[model samples]
Target: MIYQIYPRSFQDSGDDGVGDLRGITARLPYVASLGVGAVWLSPIFTSPMRDFGYDVADYCDIDPLFGTLDDFDALVAEAHRLGLKVMLDYVPNHTSSDHAWFRESLTGKESGKRDWYVWRDPAQDGGVPNNWKSFFGGPAWTLDEASGQYYLHQFLPSQPDLNWRNPAVRAAMFDVLRFWMRRGVDGFRVDVIWLLAEDEDFRDEPVNPDWKPGDVEHASLDHIHTQDQPETHEYIREMRRVLDEFDDRMMVGEIYLPVVKLLPYAGTAEEPMVHLPFNFHLILQGWTAELVRGFADSYDAECRLRHSWPNWVLGNHDQHRFKSRLGADQYRVAQTLLLTLRGTPTVYYGDEIGMTDVDVPADRLVDPAALQQPDSPEAGRDPERTPMQWDATANAGFAPGGATPWLPLADDYPAVNVAAQDGDPASDLNYFRALTRLRAEYPALVGGAYRSLETPGADVFAYERMPEHGGGERVVVLLNFGGEAADVAGLAGGDTLLSSLGDRPERGAALRPHEARILRG
Candidate 1:
């Protein structure tokens, strides 16, 4: 399992009210104790803090807000010593407008690096070159009065899209990968890998008929010309080749597309692309046994058809916390499903302790999205990106010395923190520990085939992990998604190894509401 850590919100070592790399290094032991094999940190690269670390100013250096490069090296060493692979958040689609390359490109049209970023002349009618909109709002194009040309920024104006079609750009990015790989970095969670390439002809995107006002402006038009283009696959393959240069290094692309579109990101068997395309169906779909099981079943089947590996994710820095989405009652059910799924699983930081989205009032709002479109259905992601709740101390022990955190802590941090739950045998933290232990102990879960089992009703999702050689132990997982009890039959003969409620049910006992159980025969 891979654990994602948003460095700015993970832990604060310098008492600076923001998390740093040293803080993460200090917390490596705590992470290792959770049985996760690796830690994927969100961008710690040098940035201007626009969109946080997503708008990277220097690809080869660590941001001063986090720490220095030596601090990063120490973090990698510590994580390696703890047997945890360090995967970085590789934002390749764009660079901060303050990035030297972008700055040089902005100097003049005759500059040597003029083509480093996407630049175009205005449309004949003096409007945006295309019907594309920035994810942050307004047109994707920002005109530079000095150069009299418009540059594209898919997200924010401060984040200028790179011209990946330029060979020099590709070479520079690959060198950046090499620089990190040389430092013993193991893998990457590529950000917006699909956006690496766009339509060469700069065609206008078709309008989305389903879009309505009050929605995020980016969704007003279909992103055909902007995202998931055919050229993007070749770029991914090129990235895959870079990963292959280093032994055992892997990459997982962050693609928001559906399964069919997501499959090709894995590429073919011989020339594989990203090790995992980041299956986000679990996070995007409605929470229900039928819907989740169907997605899992179809996803597994699709991966198998392509001879590619599969993976699952429950929550991330960008989405609302799963606990808030699924409710406290179904917390264990979600944890069980994530750990017992057919493929690799990514556990968001603090989800193990049942952390919910903290309420951020208008006065405290800092997220650009929330600030841009205040009336949108999904207000912003700041609530979900709050500090990690370590203990019941001031600032939840996240920022020591009574320092205020970059984001507010949840109201229930005292009761809903790691320290509080670590000693409680039935607490969510212990439950998560138990699930990870089960995953480690069972070979059936490591490389076994996923078999979707038929449950008695729609309220229950059942599945079995059949052993690889057809001669070892088989693991069965049953999840009750309803609010009432479910008497799942045929599980009585199996040994009840673990239960979400912390008590093994009596042989053949009915499942409690929202309970999940792992059994082996």
Candidate 2:
């Protein structure tokens, strides 16, 4: 299992309200004890915090808010000592406006670093050079009065897009990766891997006539040439070269594309660009037997055909928690699928304890997106960024003293905190431990061939995982999505190995609503 830790919400050691590397190091044992193979940390680099840490201001240094470079080294050392591989979040497509490169580029056109960023002259109509819109709901190009040109920012204006076409920019970014590798980081979680390159000619994208209200405004355009350019693969190759210097260092890309489009990003089996291009179909598709089966089969087939590894994620800070979307009971079913899937699974921090998103009022919001458009439902990521509840103590024991949290603290934390449930065998935390232990003990569950099982219920999603050699154990995992008992047939003889709800004998077993069962055949 791959545990994903959002630094801002994990723990706050200094009682500064914000979590830091020191806080993470303090919790290493707790994380390692969970049996997770690796921990993927969200961006903790120097940033202006416009989009939190996504807008990197300094790639090689740690943000003071998160602690210093020394703290990061110590965290890496501690994580390695605990047998947990550490992966840093790598943001290559853009940088914070305060970054040295961007600051130098914005000084004037005569600056040597002018070409480091993507800048274009104003159009005849004095509007943006192109018809591209930012993902945060505005024109992609931001006018710089000092340079008399508009710099492109795909997400937020504070995050100016980098000029990947520039050889010097590519070299600088590569050097940044090497710096982290030398520091003993195991791998990287590359952010927005598909948005590395844009159209060279600065052509306007055609508007989608089928565009309707309520859809993401950025999706209104076909995105014909703004992103996913052919040149991205070459850049990825260069990145792979840097990672090749270190042994067992992996690279996972965040490619928000369909299965067919995502396949190419992983490259061929012999020469893989990315170790894993994250599969997000499960997160996007509604929970249904047919939808789940179709997505899982297609994704598995594509990965197998390409000889590329697969990675799955159900919850991240960017989206609502799985329990919140799937309902409290359905979380167990989702966890079963995540653990039993063919790929390496990523579990967001607090997901193991069944944490839900807390509500953040407009005035209390810290995210820039929510501040920019309060009327929109995009209340930003404040809800998901709330502090983790470690115990029922004051401030959920996230910090020593009772201090105001960086984000709104969860109200139900007193009853759902980790300390409250750690002793209970039926707790979600314990269930997660059992699930992770099962994955570690069974090769068929971790590195096995996946085949969908056709069961006799609309809410029941079942799949068989078979080992490659030496007895070739077969584990059948079944999940009930609906809030009703699901009769799982055709598995009467097998031994019931694990169940999310509780232990049950194998028979014409009826799965409770949102229950999951793993049978060993």
Candidate 3:
């Protein structure tokens, strides 16, 4: 299992009231206890904080907000000591306009670094190069008054898209990966890997006919010339080569394309563009069992055809919390579906405690996207990125006394926290612990082949994980998505291995409302 850590919101170790590398080092034991194999930290590099650390100003060093290089080394050493791998987030698509590289590029069009970023002259009517729109909002091009050129920025204006076409830029970025690998980062979670290359010829994107009133403005136009271009595969292959230099290390690309488009990145095991292309379809599938199951099945089949391993994520810093999206009742049920699937499951930090999205008041909004577009729900990621609920302390134990967190603490922290639930068998945190332990202990749940099992009602999604070599206790997982209890009279009678509901009959187990169960026969 992989745990995604958002540095700013994870744990604070200093008076600055921000999560530092030392804070993460202190929590290594806690993470290890959760049975996670590795940690995927969201961008922690030096940045101007416009797009958080995604707008990296320094690719090779730790941001002062997080601590120095020494602190990072200590964290890596400690995580390795605990037998846990470390994965860093690499943002190759863009860099903070403050990055020296971008700064030099702005000096003049004749500068050696001028071609390092995507820049073009404005159209005849002094408009943007094309109709391409930024994923965050507005046109993707930012007018650089100094150079009389508009620079492409797929996200925020402070983040200018890097031109991968420049060989010098490619070499420099690869060097960044090498620097981290040398510092002992086991792998990388490349952000927006598909956006690395855009159509060579600047062109207007087709208007999206499916645009709706509440959808983000970017959805109004197809990213035909702005994303998932063919050239991106070549750069991905280049990245794969860098990772292959290290032993047993893997990379997961953040590509939000369809199954067919995503499979190409997971080249054959012998030659992979990325070890795992993140599968966010589950989140996009909403809370429907049938829809979620269908997406999982199709993705598994497609990955098998490509001969690559798969992975799943329920929530991330960008999206709404899983519990908020799926409803509180289905919290444990959601965990069951994610962990039981035949793939490497990723659990966002604090998800084990059934954390729901905390609405961030307008006065407290720090997200640049939300500030730009007040009405868009997707703008503010802060709601789901509140401080980690560690205990019932004044700051939820995220910060020391008298130190306020960078973001507001969730109101439920007093009742829901790792300290309160770690030892409680009835807590969602404990249930997740049990599930992760089971995943490690049983081959039937880890690397087994997934086979769908028929359930009595539409509210339940049932599947059995069979041992790859056969002859193990075939583990069956049943998750009830409905409001009413599901009677196991329709399911096979087996010994109760684990259940979301604290208690159940020895036989003929009836799953309580929104319950999840693992039975081995």
Candidate 4:
């Protein structure tokens, strides 16, 4: 299992209200003890924190707020000792406005690095260069009086898009990759892999007739010529080359496109780009059994035909927690599906403890996207960025002196904190530990081929994971998403190997609402 740890929210060892590298190092044993094979850390580089750490100011050093390079080195060493691989978030598309390259480009029109970013002149009518909108809202281009040119930023203005078309920029980004690879880091979670390029000509995007305010503001128009450009693959290949230097290192991309569009990002098995272009269908699509089946079948078929490995994710920092999205009971079913599905499964931090998104007031909001449109439903990512709850103590034991958290602690944390459930066999945290242990013990569950199994009820989702040889173990996973009980008659003879709801009622019996079962034949 791949556990995703958002460093700023994991643990604050110094009681400074923000989690740091030292905090992560101190927590590595907990992560390893949970049976996760690797941990994907969000960006920890020097940044202005305008968009949190997404807007990177320096690629080579750790931010002072997150601790120093030595702290990070210790984190890597400790994680390695614990047998946990470290995957750092690679923000290659943009940099903080304060980054040296952006600073130089913003110096003036005569600066040598003026072309380092996507800068365009005003249109003939004095309007912004194009109709492209930022993900945070408003026009994508921001004017700089010092340079007398508008710089493009797909997200926030503080994060100006880098000119990937520039050879120097590409080389510098590659060097950044090399820097991490030399640090004994295992891999990277490449952020915004789709937004690496845009149309060379500054053309206006056609209006999206389906545009709605709460939906992603950048999706207002068809991104045909703007994103998911052909050039992205070439860059990904170069990234793969850097990773290939270290044996067993992996690269996972954050591609938010539909299943059909995600195929190319994985490349052919012969010349793979990313080890896995994250499978986000579970998070983006409806949770009904039919929808899940369709997505799984389509994705499985595509992977088989293309010879690319599959990856799955149900929750992440950007979206609502799985528990919030599916509720307590259904969340268990979702967890079963994630653990049993083919490919590497990524679990968001605090997910094992069943953490839900906490409501963040406008005054407490820190994400730039939410701050830009504070009053709207786009309350930004503050809810998901809250600190992890370790115990019922003040500040949930996330910091030393029980200070105010960087983000608000969850309301139900007292009842749901890790300490409350760690020893409880019925707890979601224990269930996750058991599930990961099961996956580790059985190759069929982790690196096996998936086959969907037919079930009587539409609410009941069932699938079989089989190992390479028919002689290997075969496990059937069943999930009931609806409120009513479900009859899973197809698996009448298999032994109940593991289940979210302890003890099987008998063969060919009914399952409770939101029940999840794993049977072996």
lDDT string for model 2 (364-442, tens) is 8888766655555653667777888999888898976666778878889999988998999999999999888888778
lDDT of 3 by residue, 271-371 (tens): 56988898888888767768777787788888788887889999999888999998888888889889989999988999988988998888889988788
Candidate number that wins on TM-score, 1 or 3: 1
Q: Model 1, 161-187: lDDT tens per residue?
A: 999999999999999999999999999
Q: Using TM-score, give the best candidate's number.
A: 1
Instruction: List candidate 2 segments past 4 Å from native.
Output: 470-472
* Model 1: how far residue 376 lies from native, Å: 1.2
Name the top lDDT candidate: 1
**Model 1 bad stretches (over 4 Å):** 377-379
What lDDT score is found at residue 66 in candidate 4? 94
Over the full model, what C-alpha lDDT does candidate 1 score relative to the true structure? 0.91
Worst 10 residues of 1 by lDDT: 486-495
User: Candidate 3 — which residues are off by over 4 angstroms?
Assistant: none
For candidate 3, the lDDT comes to 0.87
Q: What is the C-alpha lDDT of each candidate?
A: 0.91, 0.87, 0.87, 0.86
lDDT for model 2 comes to: 0.87
What's the candidate order when arranged by decreasing lDDT? 1, 3, 2, 4
